[model samples]
Target: MSSRDPSLSPTLRLRARGALANETGRFETERREAFDDGWDLPEEERLLRTEVRIERPRSALTYNRSPDLPFDRSVNPYRGCEHGCIYCFARPSHAYLNLSPGLDFETRLIARPGIAAVLERELRARSYRAAPIALGTNTDPYQPIEATHRLMREILEVLAAFRHPVAITTKGTLIERDLDLLAPMAAEGLLRVGLSVTTLDPNLSRRLEPRAPSPARRLQTIRRLAEAGVPVRAMIAPVIPGLTDSELDRLLAATAGAGAVAASWIVLRLPREVAPLLRAWAEEHYPDRAAKMLARIREIHGGRDYDPAFGKRMRGEGIWADLIARRFRLAAARHGLDRAQPPLRSDLFRPPPRPGDQLSLL
Candidate 1:
């Protein structure tokens, strides 16, 4: 990567990151940008290193009543996913922490080491009701940093001990490492996993997701999980228009052949700060088709970059959106993956016993 290169060229220097700029977030007191001081002195090109801060927890589960979502509760073990997918809808969340949704959203991470304990306590509450808690909703729970932090593992342990149900969505192959814990829960219908496979093309995957696992690797993960008796859903998430739209049928066939029991799709969404970042990335990477690709997105979102309406958010309305949906449905049906993954069972939930607790003489 050359320092003299254009400011928006991330690959020319920053390597695998997806953001085109390191602009400050919206909540910052002031905006800051670098400028040449006219000194021709040599300077080292500092590569952005991932910085992780420990977040002590006050609460573990975040509850929402969004009609658009399937689950009402979720727990994000980490903030600012390192996967660095340029089109991540979660990018704007970094701004609430006074961090940039650009590079900062990928390089600067927050790990919650104490969330498991907090979650255990919360689940033990008298008012608590059993429901499948979602993971990797905002940020991938099994992101690269999870390898060392192991917070996800700890949380899984708590859930397993309590026989609690969990639904996980991720593109990380590291999930294979937790088979020991997951296999048993899977036997009891307490878990399901959604593996996002954006595109079947490896080169396009690297440019779009950067640090995320290759598309083939995600399919392999789905196979492994399915073989383990765990329910697996192949998610063709944020399906980029013009770029990946043509590959939808191939994706369904591949994932179905790889043992994906169900398939789902979400159109590319560029909400908040994610819009400009994706536009810049497109300009830097796919200069020729960038405009056409963006135009397709506009057609899906009613002539705008995005439409956040509840029913319209996940799958936009329009001819283009309908075409993609129709294609997915037809392909999925042909591949025997027309149905959605079944919800995990919550009836088996039982809180773990605490010291000094009364013994049940069942």
Candidate 2:
């Protein structure tokens, strides 16, 4: 591979290939770094390559008791998203595996190939009670690799066979490939989808999210899903206070025009290692306004980098947050996006028969 010019800014470095540096994960007991050893080589030659490791998790469902979340359980088909959004709140999760929440979080991905089998096994348990299982809550299931792995599609097949309800959130246009499954399940009120559109500016979206689909593509995905009879919601998440917050009305308007039936927003959050990561990104990309941007974030975060407190964390707490909320509400109302779709039904759930089990007498 050709070497990238070392003189490029950090934001440009990320835009070049997803992350600025391969910092060691926080849980790692050892660390390493590179230095000039007198053999001058181009930086592009040293560009990090993405490596995916297959993980066979014993369980598929991750249950949570967090009061602020709308769902109680979620399924992550992959760990370490390739979408590589610099401000991803899920980045810190890499620490558990002794991986850096920076570059390593994006480049060194983990795929659970057996997720569908495990999900089926769990769903068939005698004690299992069906509820809407959430997908793409931590990482995008439709990330680039899914095209080859096809785990998400298999999981959907199991859900469809069992007639279980599901909810998904994603920015990947790849989800459209599964409309044959999603459309029919949605017709039964067993599925809903939310597409996150962070910003409408193509250049800004490229720099911030790096590998995720462009704003235009996401809007198209929403339109496609809505046309297929799937309930679609447009999510303007991590609404950066001074950065992308100004685009809220326009983003909502565009998605609504594309056929979204509901909308929501979450203020930008910088938790754990993500705080410094975002700070570095801002200084590199928007030096003049970096301080002002962070100051506004602090103002909403109650003078801290973040507040993990329930309910308040997602929406934040302060005048600026309140203002954003009011603006979103008004825009949604104006676009007739205030109506809520009914809850997905769990009553239709039925466990598929185990292999080699006796055939039902009926």
Best by lDDT: 1
- lDDT of each residue in 162-233, candidate 2, tens digit only: 999999999999999999999999999899999999999999988898889998998889989999999999
Taken over the whole model, the C-alpha lDDT of each candidate is: 0.90, 0.88
Model 2: ten consecutive residues of lowest lDDT = 1-10
Candidate that would win on TM-score: 1
Writing each residue's lDDT as its tens digit, candidate 1 over 99-188 gives 999988999999999999999999999999999999999999999999999999999999999999999999999999999999999899
Clash number by candidate, in order: 2, 4
> Model 1 — TM-score against the truth?
0.96
